[model samples]
Target: MLRWRPWLPPLLPLLSLLTLLVLSDLTSSSPTAAPTETGAGWSPPAPVNHLTCYFCENVENNYICNRFAIDHPCPAGTTFCRTLHIMDTRGGSVVVNKHCATEDQCRDDRVGCLQQDHQKTCVSCCHSSYCNEPVPTNYSNAVRQPKPTAPTRAVKSAGAAAAPRLLLLLAAAASRLLLLLAAAASRQLLSGSRQL
Candidate 1:
């Protein structure tokens, strides 16, 4: 009587593939299903937590400004944009800073403004994503504009979306590697059996 044990080696790979597929399906569905069901009538809103601004800081007569300004995501509890202009007559230096701010920091339209001799400082705050894109070239003539207050609470961060994507990629690579190993092992077993 021929034993059935010889067939088990070839079946192991098929079984492993099915198991991985089932596990992937289960993991992918758990996190996304509830959100889709609850938001049936409402489409998800765009991510507005990220802020972009033009940032340049000059001190001691050093000047720096570029077109390739980067977008910086605010930390938790920071929802406003701020632009600061400072000028000092000591050496005729001007500094500009654009970055994320908090509700308290931006409470007043102007955070700081002082003029002494040729020294001056001007700060303006606004509550909108990318609102600080424009940098005031003329610190003495820049005007502060009123802006709406943003919500004080911090929203969900964008990094939450990256984890699942990474997991999926790793799963795909593992599945492919398992398949190749199984193929090689099966081929070796067939050759050995034929030689018996």
Candidate 2:
């Protein structure tokens, strides 16, 4: 037989495993359960989708590190601010030449503080709003209104102006006819009296 002593080291791991199995069966009728619920330490999988941040491209290779003053500042985890901008009002829409650290880039839009119409008309228009709000944002919210439309063309009525003249002319004609009738009646009455 080969030397059993020489094989002892190589077979030691196998022997220990077998010994454990035999002892486990003898000690308990059923295997003991984990101290905690099964799979207690496991966690849910990661999210499937994630939004990426935009970078400012207003200027050449300008990296967007901060948020613009408009809209919501760089979204919490936004990586960059793009050179996106819109006119808050009509006098002149803001143009974002420089990239903002935040998503919206504007100190205060030139036309911002005031309400305006598509024609670039301000709330200060005559017969409308008297350019009241010192600060527009809060004021606009308080009085939300629709944009004003263009004025319609009006035509003048010719008869309306000639009314007084027409009345004067009719009065003159009536008076002349009445005077002639009165004179004729008076003549007839005088003649009759003389004959009597």
Candidate 3:
């Protein structure tokens, strides 16, 4: 009665049709409609990790932090034309980022490159060389020997270049002395001859 009361006000025509159909056979009736389900969704893929040089763990974001926008979709003609986005972080915000067409350009730790008109790029974060850090195996006077210490910042000596200037001045002074002695000897000899 509650359901009929709300609908009865506006559903007069449908109600009249059911009343007319009451005279029809009760056994034979139209089937009810079925409902449909849309199962349309996708699961997100896991993020991958990139290994790089020890010194270059951090990557800078683009001019804008963390956000990178690209207009070109690749492979209009070939499979090799696929382009991938690279996420890089800088500061608290992500600033540095680049895109690359090949795995060689984007993922290769040894080699970094940029493609597609500088719109995309890859960079190196190469691991530290074996000798950069000390290893225990080389201890206790081992035959293999320990790695040498990395050179530190030192002021270069300018002593070498300054030495030559002193030598040049000494040579000039020696030549001047020889000339003065020759002049004195010549003058003395001439004066003695004239007096005689």
Q: Sort by lDDT, best first.
A: 1, 2, 3
| Per-residue error (Å), model 1, residue 124 | 0.6
Better of 1 and 3 by TM-score: 1
Write candidate 3's Cα lDDT for 76-187 as tens digits: 2211111112432321322243232333332334233334442433333212121111111111211222223344212223565565566556555655654555455556
The parts of candidate 3 lying over 4 Å away from their true place are 1-157
List ranges where model 2 is wrong by over 4 Å. Answer: 1-157
TM-score of each model, in listed order:
0.41, 0.24, 0.24
Clashes of each: 0, 10, 12
Please provide, for model 2 over 94-169, each residue's C-alpha lDDT reduced to its tens digit, 9 standing for 90 to 100: 3222211322222223223333454221111111121121212232322323234544212224555466456556
By lDDT, is 1 or 3 better?
1
lDDT to native, each model: 0.61, 0.35, 0.33
Model 3: how far is 157 from its true place, Å? 4.1
TM-score of 1: 0.41
Give the top-scoring candidate (TM-score).
1
Off by over 4 Å in 1: 1-48, 59-63, 66-68, 88-93, 109-112, 136-196
Q: Over the stretch 25-91, how does candidate 1's per-residue lDDT look in tens digits?
A: 8476533322456665544544456554455555222235435445557666776677776666653
- Candidate 2, 11: how far from true, in Å? 99
